[model samples]
Target chain A: MSELDIGILALQGDVAENFMSTMAAMNELGIDGSVSQVKTPDQISAVDGLIIPGGESTMIGQLSMVNGAMNALKEKIGSGMPVLGICAGMILLAKNSKDRVVGSTKQPLLDVLDVEIERNSFGRQKDSFEAEVSLDAMDIPSFQGVFIRAPAVLRTGSGVETLGKFNEKIIAVKQGNILATSFHPELTRDVSLHKQFVKMVADSKS
Target chain B: MIPLSGDLPKSKGIKSESVDSINVTKGTSTLKRGFAHMLKNGVVMDVTTVEQAQIAEEAGAVSVMVLDKLPSDVRKAGGVARTASIRIIQDIMDSVTIPVMAKCRIGHVYEAKVLAEANVDMVDESEVLTPADENHHIWKWDFTTPFVNGARSLAEALRRIEEGAAMIRTKGEPGTGNVAEAVLHIKKVNDELRTIKSIYDSGDKQGLVSIAREFKVSLDLVEETAKIGRMPVVNFAAGGIATPADAAYLMSLGCDGIFVGSGIFKAEDAMERARAVVLATTFWEDADAVKEAQKMINEKQSILGLDVNNLELRMQDRGGSA
Candidate 1:
């Protein structure tokens, strides 16, 4: 496999966690690659894959929108650059989203994915939990999921593939090159989900 | 035994995954600690009203800490400052999409319980408010909601952590608008962390134990911190951080993030200062970006700072013994 450059969107939230996990996954998989925190459009464009770590969806989208990286991200993801959006990242990738408590928000979004998201479906930090979620597509039996002010997919378009669910709520989905999850994959010791994304990036480069 | 070659405590100490024990469990140490990770490298602003909360969110704060009044106002009132009104906290919660937080007095477990019931994203057991218990802080592990506590030294920080505080902030002189105390507190923590790391690296088990006793924390916690060379949990600079450069300076000192108490709302240009702090914090390593953010409030400075030495009440001293 050729050397790959993977970027963790660094505008806010868990960028370092994702970078460390992805690098660990690459090392475990024996993939020659590099992972770094990326903030600007050029940094986003240079990577073979990108992971938008879990954070405040409104803040991430608003900041990214103001700085022009949101448009660049849409363009790249539209053209099949492999990307993973976790929690807030999932909120950004969806076409529509509404808070479970507050109803609707005017926050910026990347409307590339055809789905609707329910923000904080499990409730606030007090309601955050650890759950065992099984994603058949990732080829892992079950993974420990950390949900913190997590978002759940309320609707999925025909193109979207349901990857996993917890409590009858959709938590993971993939459509073409875009993959998203409402749980943080970087927070756990398990690297299976990251390995899957790295595999996608490697395949794209090949 | 100190596992010198073992995995760093970054992922250690946190309970390993057990399907039967952890599945669907709220308030697990893992979940509480991971919640703090989400706010790293982001600014959390203190807001009194819905408008200020909205301004904070629009300014790109990762979260807003709802207080009954700004610290400066609380200082002037010269009365017991308690938890914020539930109505105001709920109202702010409704107005913004970001996480909403509020402060409760130290060892005020019932106040914390009320905050948890109110569904505030996080509760701060803060010194800014009058201490409810002079002898002890709340044992935070009992609650499902996470708590952030303030510390002026490594011993204080470790003691709080021992009692289940998931996050730690410097107990700078709140309402003073002075950054001196905050800087001193964080630097003190850093220096002690370095000392512990060097001792552990030297394989001095006796020294480690003595240091642990000195810190009033477990040897295991000290060893874990020594291995990681930083706080076991995310440590942020808080209290009296009035300027964007203050925020940037704290970030450069290796703090995870910042919390602005009276800084934004009491400033000459509250909105612009809020925006600037967020910008400076997010791009702390970029000189050009910090310069641009600093230029926003060109002539308007932050709140005129009160010299911390002149303050009658040293909030940092509250609830220190326990």
Candidate 2:
């Protein structure tokens, strides 16, 4: 694949770190891609792919709405533009997110992915854990998964394929050109996930 | 030079010295009054960006934690420690006059030192979402800067305090979005200490030893630790703090303050949430404030799936050869 133009959502969350990891991933794959921060709707149009970093789901949703990027993101996802959502990003892409714990605050989801997410299903911070799972579709075996206040894929539409699972919970999933993971693959040194995402973008472009 | 006397002649220079001394005395008194004033009324706000920092100040938060990320880094490799950059820290500091704090890895003294130079008032040694530091505890005495270390149990909390920590925080675990763990931890510590004091009056060494063994620690050690500072030293409650009620819950547990990372900025109404948290901590006894705080928590965004076991520190070379 030729050099790909990748953009990371910079409205909130781990914007800079995601950009660095994405660039590192591209370098590992020998793919010369230019990664930049995309906050405006216009910037979305210039990128071949986008990575929504992990953060507080509600804030990202509210900020995106306030900044006028919510609608643009929905439109982009609708157009089958390749996008990767990690952790909070995964919650935002889900059709609906159910907070397992009792609380009153609600998040405005993008509803791009046809899935239901159970927020903080793995318990609190002390209960946070990790596992290795195989993404058979991507031919990646046993990648280390990080789950911080991560959401779980409770249910998925027929179009979505479960890519990886840990402790019988779905952690990675993909639908058409859109991909979402409950764990943060970018947080790790492993770049295979990013490579897979970049390939998806390349395939979509073709 | 003329010899100095107890009572010098009323020369212009001498008179000027007397005036300067009086002014210094007045200045010290004024500073003490100001600190007391802040303790009575100062508020703390949770913020992320520089814009949010400015808004926090306007909303009456006494201090702000310069967090670009929330408590969910447990599942990832490059945790929140590596996530929050220097530029972001500088930006938030530039935007506000109130004390700005940032999260750092537990043993990453280098990061803490850098933050100290940046002039952050305090560093929250929190393990909320970031990867845990290697086993060696932070040597607080090594740094001239002050820090607030997170402790889950009384023993751990007291140890951090013993290490000369400027402040203490109950580690309820980050990203849980629940305050029950924090509540339980604080209650257990306070209750245990009470029990120890009553037993000490009876001169029951065997009873004390048994109790300490049951707790899997030493009572004398804990007492020694407490002696490093005054009892109930600057303790704050953190982790899973999502609403004003949560902040109030911590205060009720005898915490001096609360640290709300994602609760405010992540809420639908950031400004209102910030104000509510401040109110909750201040008027903790007011049922109305508690109700208001409970209503401010975000139910939908509370789900966090951070995996702590997989977050073991992997030594990766950033630029140099391993």
Best by DockQ: 1
Q: Which lDDT tens digits does candidate 1 get at residues A1-206?
A: 55899999998887778988899999999998899888999888898899999888888887897678998999999899999999999999999999998899888899988899999998888778788889998797799888899999999999999999888899999999999999998888889999999999999999
Task: Report the C-alpha displacement of residue A46, candidate 2, in angstroms.
Answer: 67
Q: Measured with DockQ on alpha carbons, how good is candidate 1?
A: 0.57
TM-score of each: 0.95, 0.47
Question: What is residue B82's positional error in candidate 1, in angstroms?
Answer: 0.8
DockQ of each: 0.57, 0.01
Best-matching candidate per TM-score: 1
Q: Pairing residues by index, what is the TM-score of model 1?
A: 0.95
User: Which portions of model 1 miss their true places by more than 4 Å?
Assistant: B1-22, B298-301
Which pairs clash in the backbone of model 1?
none
Question: After superposing candidate 2, which stretches have Cα over 4 Å from the reference?
Answer: A1-206, B1-43, B73-80, B129-133, B203-221, B224-231, B292-322
> Interface RMSD in Å per candidate, to 1 decimal?
4.1, 22.1
